[model samples]
Target: MISKLELLDNLKEDTGQLWGKMSAQHMVEHLIYAVRTGNGKLNIGCFNPPDKWPTLKRFLLSSRPFPREFINPIIGENLFPLQYENLEEAKKILEEEIKDYYRYFEENRDALLLNPTFGELNGSEWEAFHEKHFTHHFSQFGLL
Candidate 1:
């Protein structure tokens, strides 16, 4: 297992040559989008229904397999689509966001945020999801 900081640093070395699709710039922007969620600037979805709240909560808290459909996104929402230009600028933005996310995780290990989809999570879950999900994509790009 790699430390979060180490994994982050390693991201700088990944050139996105093997991602097969996204340019390095897009990958960096995707990372930024995830970190922005923790920073309270991005909302995953608009709202949750009362009837499905428990199901949504369980999905967030439980160790269930993520549906394959969630892999691709549809646009026209608050969520930013993963596409970017200017590789150097995107890398700089991503690096700064990751640093901010790391500090937030360290300081707010038990705080709750109103996640648009998951409802809320303590800091650990937030950090775990962010790290794991980011690593998943990075690996998809052959970064690891």
Candidate 2:
């Protein structure tokens, strides 16, 4: 598993040349939104029960991928941010969210957490999904 610190460090690098998608700043904001969703702070505007997930998606969510889409991404406007600015501040907030996520998982790994897009995810499932999803986006922006 990639260390969270390492992932954060990579975010400092310029991604404009590496991934012609979102600016590194916007990318950081995007990351914040993701962490918030996992922590029960933000809702992605949809729901997918754990049973509704495909076998492949459930499996892949538990580990790092060889970089293909990593895992199937859900489609919805509310799941992601429509806009953002100030990459530095966004990164700081994102880092905080990640820490909170880790703490939450550590404390409640066995508890059932309500997921906006997956009804209720047990602690392990949430960790796997959060980690894999973050890794996927980090890789997408060339920061992994």
Candidate 3:
């Protein structure tokens, strides 16, 4: 399996995905937000009820890849506005964000962060989310 950081290695800006409406750069920018979500920089409320999180988190940490065309309840069907000017910039920042995600947990060993789908998650759990998410999007662009 490719590490999340390496998932972008060969992703091209115009690559057509097996599913979804996102362009390659849009996918990269989307992933940048994901890293922020778990690293204490971005705060998002859980959409699920408190009692649902344990089951959701277990599914997130599981080996099953996210189903193609899965809808993000918080984000909906539209793509978020892209932050960087281009694909290369977005990908570069995504790499930096992934590094920050790891560094943050290293410095704050017990810190927990909120994810809109999974409630509060510790470092290891966040890592699992990242793994699943990266695989999902990378698969979208056929990068994995």
Candidate 4:
């Protein structure tokens, strides 16, 4: 698993992509939202389809790579509204969010975080999801 610090190191303003619509900055901001969600700072409700498709959630949570161009229902196609003015600003905020996210997990190791799609996730699960999620987008931007 690629650590967040390593991912941040590889990420650059000029990083080009082999897939997806997000610029590097957009991707960083997108990750910020995800980290925040995992830290319990953001709650967008749940997309609880586990009852309808029991194996789906387990599959997603498993050690499987996320498909390229998979539309994140929470973020959507257009991308979330920009939280910062430019790439540098976004990167700065993202770094801060990363710190906060780990801090949150440290303080509340047993907390149950709600995922929009996968329902509730514990710290370890969230860490795994984050690793996969970041790896997917980083690879998307050719950062991996």
Best by lDDT: 3
Q: How would you encode candidate 4's per-residue C-alpha lDDT over 15-64 as one tens digit per residue? A: 88789888888888888888889877899987666474346557767878
The TM-score of candidate 2 is 0.66
| Tens-digit per-residue lDDT, 38-143, candidate 1 | 7666767526655676677666556654442253442332345545456567766777777776676677766666555555656766765665566566675565
Which regions of candidate 4 are displaced past 4 Å?
50-54
With a 3 Å backbone cut-off (N, CA, C), the pairs that clash in candidate 2 are: 48-117
**Per-model TM values vs. the true structure:** 0.62, 0.66, 0.93, 0.87
lDDT values for all models: 0.59, 0.61, 0.84, 0.78
All predictions: root-mean-square deviation over Cα? 4.5, 4.1, 1.6, 2.1
Which residue runs of candidate 3 sit more than 4 Å off their true CA positions?
none
TM-score of 1: 0.62
Best by TM-score: 3
Alpha-carbon lDDT of model 4: 0.78
Residue 63's lDDT within candidate 4 is 78
